[model samples]
Target: MPTVLDRLNLALHYAMETDERVTMLGEDILDPYGGAFKVTRGLSTKFPKRVLTTPISEAAIVGVANGMALRGLRPVVEIMFGDFVTLIADQLVNHSSKFRWMYNDQVRVPVVVRTPMGGRRGYGPTHSQSLEKLFLGVPGLKVVAPNALGDPAELLAAAIADDDPVLFVEHKLLYARPLLEPGKGDLIDFQVEQTGGAYPAFTLRPADSARLTIACYGYNFELARAAALDLLMEHEIFVEIVLFSQLSPFDLAPLFSSLVRTRKLLTVEEGTLSLGWGAEVAARAVERMDGLRVRRVAALDLPVANAKSLEDAILPSVQDIVNAALSLVS
Candidate 1:
């Protein structure tokens, strides 16, 4: 079984081999260094010409990639960390994302910006942050994040092939987890199914009844799933977990259908409590479902501290999800 990072490497390799116009640029991504997380490991060695090693400038990387896209090339730019994506906001919001619309569909900007997010590794304030919600409503830009239960490699390939500017968010913790293969021993009695659309999504339901539904993405799903399983064993709370592959243009059909079975909903995310992605799900549920109870669990609105205790205190934990689920169900 390959780790999620291994699958990402395979996806990048497949994109490079299939598309001659696809190029990758990032800092310290050369053969020896690979990358900060080594997600791009062996790529530069494999495709010497298309793999570009850049300086420590996120803005510059986006600018160069935007130019490359304008000149008819699919450029994948990796910002070493998710925190630095703010530095490239001007380029993404003002130029690249607007190219297709501002020009009356005369041109297309097929650029993918990849970065790692979340804070389980004690990366502290700046290094670990789930800032995808910051770019959620940005027009002409698509935001996608892979959870523990889906094929990130296939989603990455889809993002690379799409004709829009995509913010590909990878949770730091999910990179090392095994890919969720179908019909695996652990999923014997569970029904695992995937949804097909611009954004691929997966749902896991137990053989019996589902008393509640949990919605999440990125590495946060690890905590969410653990809580769900614990609830099942301790309290007889059957849960259906829905993982989103695309954040913006969020595909909510799976969530809506799951809600039909279980009127209670709990949304978990690594971002801060206010104005987060979980809030969006809660609001949508209020609008679409009558008499639906929705609760959200997210990190506190503060910088992630370096110490393990402080990080745990600020971020959402499995206990938080368990308590929230119990409350929602009750």
Candidate 2:
């Protein structure tokens, strides 16, 4: 019954309680302020020694967490906004991600880099951007984005316990929303539609037919699910949706299996189109699956505008998914 944000807070509480080595680092993530979205509220008070506040430097915050993790602590770091991830790219990619392999498995960087992405609240171009796609290419980091149906708490717990570093992406708009069924009402109690193995991708098939498939993750998945339902109800087009809880080490099995029936794929994400994460999914699909058609719906290559109108125009929407799927079907 908890919201995605609620689940995330529970995950942190659970991690700290279960493991003495679990620590949290971020700016103003203390009581009252909680965090930019209050996801880390009260943790500092609960676990005073483990939950430490940091300066305004994102790079320093990550560097400190990396050092702590290298010393055998499970560090959960919160980057205030997704856009700020660029500031810590060097530490995250070059250092945290490489330490395990570089040390020949003698060391483990079990760090969970948590950050909020997307822009429905119109925080302007700098604060609101879905740049998760940028980290998808990093060799050792695992990219994870939990949808409404999936439990962010469970995923975060898994990420915290992981031996390698994890990029846990949370969308801004999804914080307050209740975890509802893909196309169902808010009253519907949240349930994980599909339990994923290896790569943890949840599949939701509203009906038996898979005329088209929509593969997406993060908060934007609500838009994709709504469009899928509209297509199913009005146009009688059944679309199977796969929401990924884990982005890296992406297992193409579920997608390829769905493609066997659908034959058409429409990948969606909030990140910009140029070399976006969807592009990688499409490329891999074609490389393995023969006679498959793939289309992608993503944000335009421009700074996300602050105004609601401009933001809607720039980002992916329900109409965008519908149009892309219609094109694939036609």
Give TM-scores for every candidate, taking all chains together and pairing residue i with residue i: 0.97, 0.95
Which residue pairs in candidate 2 have backbone atoms (N, alpha carbon, C) closer than 3 angstroms, thus clashing? none
C-alpha lDDT score of every prediction, in listed order: 0.89, 0.85
lDDT tens digits by residue: candidate 2, 20-59:
9999999889887888899998798899898888889999
In model 2, where is the ten-residue run with the lowest total lDDT?
183-192
> 77 in model 2: Cα distance from truth in Å?
0.6
Worst 10 residues of 1 by lDDT: 180-189
Candidate 2: count the clashes: 0
lDDT of 1: 0.89
Colliding pairs, model 1: none
Report the alpha-carbon TM-score of model 2 versus the true structure: 0.95
